[model samples]
Target chain A: MAKTIKVRARAKDGVVTVKMLISHPMESGRRKNKKTGKLIPAHFIQEVVTEHNGNKVLVANWSGAISKNPYLSFKFKGGAAGDSLKISWVDNQGKSDSTTAKIK
Target chain B: MNTKRRLFLKGSMAAGAAGVAMSAGLLTPGMVLAAWNEGAFKAKSVDEALSALMGSSSTEAGKIKIKAPDIAENGAVVPVTVSTDMGGVDTIAILASNNPTPLTSSYELGEGALPYVSTRIKMGKTGKVIAVVKSGGKLYSASKEVKVTIGGCGG
Candidate 1:
């Protein structure tokens, strides 16, 4: 599966700033399909994890209440240019995907 | 608040309860995903939701900062950012008080992760956007009100 997360990491003054935008339906399960008249199955990102140089830096927990295509940003101490940062997420339905970015 | 927005918020809360029920039996066997905190998302009241998620009541801390718009043009997408200098922060959770499911999202920070988070959440109407930070085995919180105008029909 193609993960919908776009990640950017930049090292500035010894700290790394990481930002990402995830693409997904984030269906709340309450919204019904207009044609079939059936509740759309809930399929939202339940967890997100970010790793830097093999060290876990950030993790997020989410629910269907979040808006479609969630946006996440954060900063952390101690990262250098050319370092690698990986971001990944697992949806409620057990689907998962990941991507990596090189710090600028 | 607009009557339609109020009605939608109510509907969300009811659906939130149903969302909890769905998770109970929805997960397939041998699933790789971790279990969710159904109690917090399903709780009707903000206090209840917070305690359920954090496992205890939180104190208002001065080190926390929350940034959000005083007036939102759209309830469907409102940007929120939370940052804190508290040490050993474990998780950052955001809640929209007037939404059917008051708890919106949470972030877990490890030793290397910064004590900051930013995200966009959907709100049902006018409400306070709250940020709760857990550090040193305690929870702290900050909040600000946001008025959401839908298609210029709101006050």
Candidate 2:
């Protein structure tokens, strides 16, 4: 599966800042289908987790209110150049994906 | 509005939608409601939802820095960042006061995680964007009012 998540981690002044974008529909289920005129089922990433060098850094519980292709960013303590940073997300439908990046 | 009353009203509204879905044979009511956090979303008051999310009504006053634009051109997407120097921060939750579902989302930070978070959220109207930080088993919060505008018409 193509990694729908894109991540970038940069270490500056002993702090690691991570930013990411995930591709997903994030349908709210309240909107009607243009053709069928029927309500669409809600589909969105419900959980996101970020890790740094094998240690958990941040975790989020999200919902459909998040716009499609959600963008998230955060900073953490103690990240060195070449440190591994990973981000993963799971959708309401149980589908999941992950991506990894190296701190610059 | 009280938390329980608002929840009940919202639940009724959801049930109405589910009724339509059921009659149309589109889906089971439970299936539709199962995907989201009904309690947090239905909450009509910030304190109501925060208490439920943070597991307490009492919060200690602490330093919580919230960064957001004073004005938003589009209500569809508004950028907000929350960060704090507080130690042992465990969770960060964002709430947009005035949105039907005030609680946008909450982050649970594990041991050794940072106390910063950023994201974009939707707003239906001009209101306060609140950020709640949980640290050392206590909740602290700060909020900033963002004026939402539509086509240059500020609301």
Candidate 3:
């Protein structure tokens, strides 16, 4: 599987700001296919977890109401430059992806 | 008196079982996420969703700030930011009152994280975007109404 997640973490004044973008359809299962005229299945992400320096920082539960190609940004404390940050997400269809970035 | 004793025993037994389960690593995040808040996500109204998600619909107005455009040009992707400076905040939940599924997302912040989240959500129509923050076990909420030029959910 290709890398479906893009993440960046930067540290400033002992605070780390993390931004991530996940590539997913985020289909609400309510929209109809323009060609098939059939309802699209709901295939959005359900869980997102972020870790800083191997410590769990945040866990987000999401629904199909989120926009396609979701973007999320958050902040944390006690992080420094050169620390590792990891982000992972799982969709309703049982598919998942993760990425690791360094705090700069 | 007998009924009360039996209930107490049952509660203690359940607590013991849960402790064992946690010690045995049976309650990992992967296992828990498999059972996402289905009832809350499927609820059509804000009250139903709130009660389903947090078991309470009552919230006190607080200093939670919701920063979003007054008018969203594209309902499909309306940017929103919910933040608060209150201490001991552990959870943040976002809801769109008019969407088919009123609850859009809920975030659990750990000890190292701050009480802030920024993301984009879909709005079916013009409605209030509510941010509910759980701090010190109390729920605080703030909302902003955003006018949508076009509906997002494709009917």
Candidate 4:
């Protein structure tokens, strides 16, 4: 199934601090099968982008060591109440999901 | 008749001794309690963990603010922060949606302290990160997805 993400942002004093969490299995290929003793294929998200008021503010790149359902937090400049922040992510399998939050 | 009475007395003594042993720490309360706790903590899934921690089957959204990267370069140390503007927030918890044990950590906020926390966690791969907050005797949650480039769990 495609990953799901949620974003929450608050704007204050010309800066917006955003918080987000995403759902995914994040299976590392290193895990061995108990039945057949074979390695699992590596699957993970690779990149994330956050934009405030349609302007890019923060970006993050991830490796497999990250636990499943990764959590991220950052701040951006110049967003106000009623402004929208957009967040998008791309996984290793080329799957992507994006969501937006209105500043409150 | 004397032998019969003596044998009856010995049998009664053995029964009394056995009863005393039963009450005198022969059956440890600690072991039973430990086993119960292990079962309690054995959540095979994220939803199960949440239910166990919050004592509720469902959690509402919008009372908590969970922050994490949309993409992490290193899964070993992805930073996470949780904050709440809602008044009377008592606790905040972080859960990895795809982790074997999804409930990563929980923090209890005191009355005087601010209702916010930040920490780093390990990620197995790309997945959703959830934050649940308890306030006014209710549970609320939020989630975001993060992408991992390199395997943090030695993949």
* lDDT, each prediction: 0.82, 0.78, 0.91, 0.67
Query: RMSD per prediction, one decimal?
Result: 13.4, 12.3, 11.4, 17.7
Candidate 1 Cα deviation (angstroms), residue B76: 1.3
Model 2 chain B weakest 10-residue run by lDDT: B26-35
Can you list each candidate's DockQ? 0.38, 0.32, 0.48, 0.06
lDDT of 4 by residue, A1-104 (tens): 45488777887877666678888666555677677888877666655667765555654444343557777665545677898877787665566788888988
Find the 10 residues in a row with the least total lDDT in model 1 chain B: B27-36
The top-ranked prediction according to TM-score is: 3
Off by over 4 Å in 3: B1-35
Clashing pairs in 1: none
Q: After superposition, how far is residue B25 of candidate 4 from its true place, in Å?
A: 18
Error of 3 at B123 (Å): 0.1
Q: Candidate 1: which stretches are off by over 4 Å?
A: A35-37, B1-35, B151-155
Model 1, range A1-104, lDDT digits (tens) per residue? 87688988888988888989999888766677778887778888888889887888887888777778989999988788998888888888777889989999
* Interface DockQ of candidate 3: 0.48
List where candidate 4 sits over 4 angstroms from the true fold.
A1-104, B1-41
Q: Which 10-residue span in candidate 4 chain B carries the lowest summed lDDT?
A: B32-41
lDDT of 1 at B21: 82
Candidate 1 positional error at B46, Å: 1.8
Per-candidate total of colliding backbone pairs: 0, 0, 0, 45
For model 3, residues B1-52, the per-residue Cα lDDT tens digits are 6999999999999999999987666445456455688888899889898898
How many Å off is the CA of B109 in candidate 3?
0.3
lDDT of 4 by residue, B1-155 (tens): 69999999999999999899877654453443332222213465767876776677488886567778889898767788877788777666677776665665655443233467665677667888888888888888899898877645653
**Model 2 ranges with Cα > 4 A deviation:** A34-37, B1-38, B41-44, B151-155
Sorted on DockQ, best first, the list reads 3, 1, 2, 4
